[model samples]
Target: MQSNKTQQGGVLGVFPHYHWRATEQEVDMAMPAPAPRPLRLNAEPQNLVIDLRRTAIVVIDMQNDFCAPGGWVDHIGGNFAADRAAIEPLQALLPALREAQVPVVWVNWGNRPDLANMPPNQIHLYKNSGSGTGLGDPLPDGRGNVLEKGSWAAAIVDELAPLPGDILVDKHRISGFWDTPLDSILRNLGVKTILFAGCNTDQCVLHSLTDANFLGYGCVMLEDCCATSSPDFCTQATIWNVKKCFGFVTDSTTLLAALQAPPA
Candidate 1:
């Protein structure tokens, strides 16, 4: 009697083409690709038909430090309320995106505890006066270091805490791609398009979106899902730049509708 046990191939990565399965007799490299999940989104400048299978939503800096009371923004007297606006929209949109099988990437400022990776310029952004609480500085109420990894200042807000399947990337620079594993992670996941959302639209969000654009990824800004404490003009300018130079601009409502609509 012949043995019934047979060798089985194992998947190498998230993508089909790049990964392979190997057995005792043969190695199959041409795995069947999943069908594209295309959705039509109404956006500024023009409309778009994105493949959800190759797309991911990047939520930037939606952490306690930026949105919650007794955090960095609040401690500095910045208008934390403005940044809080993105919370409700995100609450509604993230679950829908997850349901649609779209990857959720949370890119927050999580610096090293020793501040060794930080430069003077980056530190100065938070402490322009060369005094007071800055990056890696302990909060007044002892809420751990500002934006330091594993600290309350670096944790995501409770309302928008990442679920088990969500991806978290700690970024030390304004651009999430700079000196970070974000690009590598997206590449491994076979993501070609990025939907941008989060706080300080003109600063972190805009810079990250621009970096994504430069890296040849399709960029889309979710207007209502991003907030800023800056003047209204700043928000306007960021939207204009995203539409004219960087990428398309749309809101979560439009995206949610697209996700729910039957694929055309």
Candidate 2:
């Protein structure tokens, strides 16, 4: 290794070469963070396009058991507010969507009386999860029973109650399509695009959305209208994955505006 450190008087060693210092020039190249994706805005990443006219709203697991106080959510030590947060946005979005003639489908947890078709793993998980409640368990207030078909606790919230023409599909698993007629109903209705909103964004909402995407349905997640009892990171990660892979992500405000916006 040779040393070239003996430069003297702004000159290179043994040569009259001058030492040159280059000045750094400022650049106007500050890249700003991208604007967040808007609600109900049609974004076609990976060739997925959302058609509002063909879209149906699927509200997942926003039943009394999950959102109402003294229901399974509160019984499981979950913050009621976390599950209840979606109510207002859903209430606001539903009327507009209904007026637009979009079909409203409620996918809820409604198990059979015999629990004959219930999976053992799910039963064990919920029964031993320290909530002391399981399928067919009586709710605290006795207004309805948990997971029992046609029970009040298994019903949708009053604020966003289904109208006369709305469809109701009972689901046994986290994913609405698992052992349910949700897919058949949507397909029969000629629905190709689905907008999802409801409780437990990371669990039921994520599962159902993934299933819908897998079934080749264009999915749009109503971000503000989907919530979870888990930490915020869980919901954020769900939204990220949805936008990155599953489908589009938007909020209620943006969705409402998009729904009300005149066609181009």
Candidate 3:
């Protein structure tokens, strides 16, 4: 290691012009930062031979409690805008996905008051839930079946409401794949890398992506397209967890670009 020093007023800055004498430690401190990695777009849509008829988009837990009026989460100091933004882009993308024959699965959690089928512990947790339960209903039309994780408010919202043909899968926990029909249904429909956008990024979304990865399917967490009970956890999960380990933490722009571009 060799180093040269320059003086600026009262401070010293290291220069590559090393004196004939220098130590390894001095050189290490002056090393340039690593180069930025290039952005990568997933190639699945290009690689697969099937037509647009093959892909399915799974939109998770966007129900009233998580996104709209009369939702219990709002009563508990939750931020609505944090989750609502997911709606605009998704709504904007719907027409294209629909015309392309990609199935849009709307999943919401709901439970019965008696907790008839759920465990006692879960039943206790959902005791006061008003939205996720059958109390108010998950889907606006009640056409597509709703999967109630309901001990109380596990339902998806009415804003980006479910359509008559949208498939609904139920779950009792955060990861939609945990003890649920999600994996089976996706496999049946031939969904590989699911383009997901929904509520509570730190928990459900993160859990779902981890499961999706372990299960061998690809996953991407749309960054600006998700929210949590707290903004901090939302950003942390999207930036650190999803970006570093679980999956690609991308955005709506990249998604729409991938959608419009011809399949690879």
Using TM-score as the measure, the top candidate is 1
- Tens digits of per-residue lDDT for model 1, 1-264: 011123233655544424667677778877776678788889989999998888999999998999999999999899999999999999999989888778899999999999899999999988899999899999977898999999999999999989887899999988889999999988877789999999889999999999999999999999999999999999999999899999999999998888888756
True-vs-predicted CA distance for residue 81, candidate 3, Å: 3.4
Better of 2 and 3 by lDDT: 2
Candidate 2 lDDT tens digits, 14-42:
21111232225433233232232222374
Identify the superior model by lDDT, candidate 1 or candidate 2: 1
- Residue 15, model 2, lDDT: 14
Residue 86 of model 1 has an lDDT of 96
> Candidate 3 residues 1-264, lDDT tens each?
111334333223332221122354443334342232222354322222223433467777787666764465554455766777778877777666676556787655655434465665554454455335433234443332233454234556555666765788876666788778888777655566676777777767777778888998767667766766665855674557655665566666765676677644
Deviating ranges (above 4 Å) for candidate 2:
1-49, 129-131
Candidate 3 segments whose C-alpha is farther than 4 A from its true place = 1-54, 120-155, 262-264
Candidate 3: worst-modelled 10 consecutive residues by lDDT: 10-19
What TM-score does candidate 1 get on C-alpha atoms?
A: 0.93
Backbone clash total, candidate 2 = 0
Q: Which is better, 1 or 3, measured by lDDT?
A: 1
Per-prediction TM-score: 0.93, 0.80, 0.66
Q: State the displacement of the C-alpha of residue 227, model 2, in Å, after optimal TM-score superposition.
A: 0.7
What lDDT score goes with residue 52 in model 1? 88
**Model 1 weakest lDDT span, ten residues long:** 1-10
